[model samples]
Target: MITENTIAAISTPLGRGGIAVIRVSGKDAIAIAERVFRSSHGGEVRKFPSHTVHHGLVVAPNSQEPLDEVMLTVFRAPNSYTGEDVVEISCHGGVFVSQKVLEAVLEAGARLADPGEFTKRAFLNGKIDLVQAEAVADLIQASTERSHQEAFQQLRGGLSDQINAVRNSLVDMLALMELELDFSQEDVEFLDRQEIEERLRRSIEELDKLIASYQRGRFLREGAKITIVGRPNVGKSSLLNALLGMERAIVDETPGTTRDAIETQLDIKGVLFRVIDTAGLRQAKNRIEKKGIAITEFHIEDADVVLFLLDASEGVTRADEKIWQQVERLSQKRREMFPAKIIIVGNKIDLGNQLTKGSFDPEMGKWPLVLVSAKTLTGIPQLNETIFKAVFDERWERGDAVITNVRHLQALQKARQHLGFALETLKQGLSTEFAVVDIKGALEQLGAIVGQTTPEEVLDRIFEQFCIGK
Candidate 1:
């Protein structure tokens, strides 16, 4: 709930740093900060103009005992972060000292803020819409340059403007239909059925484009998962180290050296992929090796892409064929839910030049193949390019606003469904009232995306994902 009480919290990350900040906001933010602060310039904080910073000492409210030397910045109401009076105290960056400063502010008069309360206030106060509010969280969690660009674009109203425009067009159409119904006794039509159907078709097409971008957006927002699987001693661990350019995995010439999955992140052209190196997939010789293979299968089931590694010098062994068969069965099981893309990787090509074209041709079906030597770093660049192309399609080259949030995607899906039903109704030459019902349903879903008609519990769930003090 949006409260009238002044709020105080430690806004900076809790760690040893050069500086840390405690933020206070509400109507009495200035007066509450003034109670414990004494300016080095010999003036009251309440009298200072907005956007001014002052050197000060944080003192006890009762005894005025100095606690720490600090800098206090003030922002007046209607322009502050929460659209209320805000005061931020920059104190010495010790965990204990920052705590004492915040304790003094709360002792004077301020409630401890809930997680995301500041940003929630901004949304309720109309400083920004819900889409922009979610973008604030995404901006903080962005892992790659591409993800950062998409989040910042949404925060700047690139996505919000389009959503609002769509909503307004539907609202205008709804008003015309309702107005025509009100004057129906005179037997007049305000809008043609053909025109409404055409408008709806355009809106549905727009939503389809937005929905199609989720694959790329999902990769940018949540990094892609690429799991590497192969038989024992097939250079899985070596490939992991080569791709990350570090000794992330333990590599040994002996088989079964790795007994679990080793996961690391790789950034390829601004796209992040979580690369996992798994234990050898074969008939386990021991209980421990069997458990390791089980974990490998679990990751393969959930992976967006699987790199099935094989020893190129050996040229398609029986064990490699067995693992491929298992992967095919798993693909059939998960075809409807996150079907993993399997790429056949032939490793140790530096031993010979036989695999110049990445082909076991008829030996391995129609799967994409790449040849590399993880020991010598041969063909690593081509392997990276292959992984990128295997997941991202041509839809990623467009410049439209992407749908990154799951909430936004769900809303878009529902709105598109309603619009679809309405369009079908209009094409069937039904009454405007029947199509109007679905159009209003579509409008409500679109409103929820921008927080116009969102419920209280939904707002709570959204803001709960943020850290306290925002």
Candidate 2:
């Protein structure tokens, strides 16, 4: 698994900072580094001990010319990130200085590293599996705290351990079924039928749990889309402003002041929510208004949650009923395609407790009824709690393994399908050979997730998403 050529790149972001690192890896890394680096102690980089840092000056190989003063750290073979002979040069941060150091390394004999080549090499060298390798990218691109925590857990082999546990059970069951297949002609049964069924059931249950976590995992990874909709002048904009703790949307006394969707992001309890304040639902007076209303409806269709605001002071009116009817029709139409949670929010409660126990009573428990005064910022915390509870489970902990990557989710789904097929075949008293086929299929799918049997093209595509020198 050793790579032939040495690779080098600026590991840090290219900008003006206190320092920037240039990483060199592969069999010839130390040799290439030694060619250009002259230690302050007058020793070659090759003689440096593993995990030791040395003060050095990078010089040109052809002519003795100092390029930059740097701190060179050496990591010997099988001990570095790429599991190769690695040298990391920490140089003064500057666009030109970092480039000069990288150029010196390349001139000394190392090739320019491709995007994600470092992580790809780690995967190829058996230092990490595909799940952990993908987690490297996830950790880097994580925007929110929850995403960061999930990525860190995945990188620490949390998701991989869970997948491998199920995979092991599947493998054991497959072995037993194969053993029984060898004695198909005899009446003797090597494995109990009920035992095989139970094993398959457990494996399927594990897969199902992982699959179920994807929805919340995805919301954590990529923020949830929340659309706020109501009739004109119902304080929709005020609620958006209150939720974000800023005046993002314009509040006006005139109805239909906001004829377009205004979007912003808010993080609630480590989970990111992309909130959209749409134009009020009403009879459009102009062509522009009509287009804006259409966009609002479109956002509703695509929203993960809808905050249907009502004026508590005025109570539910005929216009509000008409809007509810439209919402119901849309929900029915998009029940399969767009399954969004609708929370009825009673706004302007600070004006007075004018709301009566009518069609939209808080006691009915039909939909989540949250009372809030966007003007005074009253009951906002409760609204936030309701929103958080709508999407995530109360029992889920931060360290729990969540399937955030779409690739992992797809692999789990394929494995679940095969496991279901295997279970069905076993229950029907089919030939052991038939069940063995599905079991093998399930095993292969699971193996792909952890890089035991992944295709080269799939690996290439996954690593390609990563930046260079990762």
Error of 2 at 86 (Å): 1.2
Q: What is the per-residue lDDT of model 2 for residues 1-470, given as tens digits with 9 covering 90 to 100?
A: 99898899999998999999999999999898889899998987777899999997999887869999999999998998989999999999999999988888899899999889999999999999999998999889888888889988999999999999998888877887787778777866867888888888999999988888988888988888899989999999999999999999999999999989999999998889999999999999899999999998888887888898889998888888888777655644554733778788999999876555456633233778899999999999999999999888888877778888788888898999988988898789887688889889988989999999999999899888889888
Give the per-residue Cα lDDT of candidate 2 at 16.
Answer: 99
Give the Cα-based TM-score of candidate 1 against the true structure.
0.94
**Local distance difference test, per candidate?**
0.87, 0.88
lDDT, candidate 1, 6-42, per-residue tens: 9989999998999889999898898998899999989
TM for every model, in the order presented, reads 0.94, 0.95
* Quality of model 2 by C-alpha lDDT: 0.88
Clashes of each: 0, 0
**What is the clash count of model 2?**
0
Let me know the TM-score candidate 2 reaches against the reference structure: 0.95
Q: Candidate 2: give the clashing pairs.
A: none
RMSD of 2: 2.1
In angstroms, the error of model 1 at 351 is 1.2
